[model samples]
Target: MSIRLDLARDSGLTLSDALSVLLPTPAQDLSDLPRTTELVQPFKPFHDHFAAQGFSSVDASDAPCGDVILFVPRAKAQARALVHHACQRASGKIVVDGVKTDGIDSLLKEVRKRVPVEGPISKAHGKIFWFAADADAFSDWALSDMTLAGGYRTVPGVFSSDGIDPASELLIAAMPDRPGARIADLGAGWGYLSSRLLEREGVHSIDLVEADHVALDCARHNISDPRARFHWADALNWAAPEPLDTVVMNPPFHTSRAADPALGRGFIAAAARSLAPSGQLWMVANRHLPYEAALEAHFTRFEELGGDARFKIFNATRPRRRAGAS
Candidate 1:
């Protein structure tokens, strides 16, 4: 995105007169832009990253701005919704930039059908283009909140937005009737597992830790239980407010299209750190993912709890101390 912006600048595209710019869904800082640029990022780690760099960051923005730079996300519905949102808030030019794999080509084609699109400078397996803001042009692309079975509220771009994940369903069935008292659901996307865990006999309280603010907002609406607590946090680093008697998770295994087992490993380490001395962990994952090593390193005993061919469940106990003094 930085490269595309630099090329655009050299090709006579300018933002000198723009008083303020809104960067929505930016994965990283575009340092060349003005220091006052505001970032609209929902993912907790990215929001925290920009906040620490002295930039004003928010989960969402409705305030009008001089200009807008939208970095497209992978979800097509989400990408179009952001464009519609940008048109509503941008008073000046709206710059759209994204990689081809993120459906930039398709989005550009859609935008051209609505308004006159400017230079589509291609670089880095992506394209960047701009157009004048016209709210009415993209009005039809506006996304509404999604409602799944059992009245679960979700939104575009959240994991399992369409319906309950089959893996989570499998995990729920495999969970004991009385897992524990205090529990933490790491990477608890939209609180499906947490809500079910609340129904279990021994569960007293549950912390729903998720990275996506949008999903967390859905969770807040979907669950009205007083026993539930929501935390917008990176599950890898999130500290449980109290020592947890059990940790249940369907930890995300990737940040991008490619699968990364390390993400799941981090969740395992976090669960180990958050658990009480005798705490147990109940987790589910794809059958092919190699998480046994991570589980062995973090706990004294672990075993497969049986799952269908597509998924696997694990039960682990006796968390181990890290290689350092308490």
Candidate 2:
């Protein structure tokens, strides 16, 4: 991103003095951008990361701006939707930057078809380009909330946006008939498990804790039961409002394309901290990832429930107290 910006500046690209908004940027140095720059990051972890650095950050933005810099997400439909939204919100240039793995070449080709594009400066296996904002040219690209087969509401770019995740399905089927009265679904994506858990008897409240703001918004639309509560937060740091009787999850293992088991491990630790002393944890995971050690560290006892070849289920009880923990 810095390379492109430098090249653009060398070639006489001058940004306006008004607000410049950057959407969906990861944790990085932003000293080069104008002080007026605001960040729009829907993912809670990244949003909090920037917020800690004293940058103006928000989960979403609707205000008009002098310019908009978009960091393309992996989802193609989501990338297009962001472009359309950027055009709608920007009064000046619209900068698009993305890595090759994220389909920057394809996005550039598609954008060129709609408007005149300039300076596709390439460096470090990625490309960056800019174009004048023309909202009319990309009107059809605006995306609305999608309705899945079970009447679930979702939007582009969220995890498992297309339909219910198979791993989550496995966990749901493996869950005990009456798991607990007070429960939390850590890393809950769009509340699919929470919705199904609501069907079970003796469920007093189900907290849907998710990091993605967009997914949590969909969860709100899909769930209307009074017992369902939604929280847009990083599950690694989030604590249940009350000591949970049970925690259910198909914890996310990836922050990017590569699988990271540490994310799931963090979820297990967080769940243990949120549960009561005698509380239980019910979780599903991919077959190959190792989480037994983490489970053992956090809980007194754990055993495999049941799962097919692709996924495994575990039920753990008796969260262990830390040495110095009160």
Candidate with maximal TM-score: 2
lDDT for each candidate structure? 0.87, 0.87
What is the RMSD, in Å, between candidate 2 and the native fold over all Cα? 1.6
Per-residue CA lDDT of candidate 1, range 1-326, in tens? 38887788788776634433343444544665565777888888888777777778888888888788888888899999898988998888888888999999999999999999998999989999999989899998898998889889998899999999999999999988998999999998988999888888978999999999899999999889999999999999999998899999998988878999999999999999999989999999999999999999999999999899999999999899454311
Q: lDDT (0-100) at residue 60 of candidate 1? A: 86
In candidate 2, the residue pairs with backbone N, CA or C atoms under 3 Å apart (3 or more residues apart, or in different chains) clash, namely: none
Q: In model 2, how large is the Cα lDDT of residue 164?
A: 85
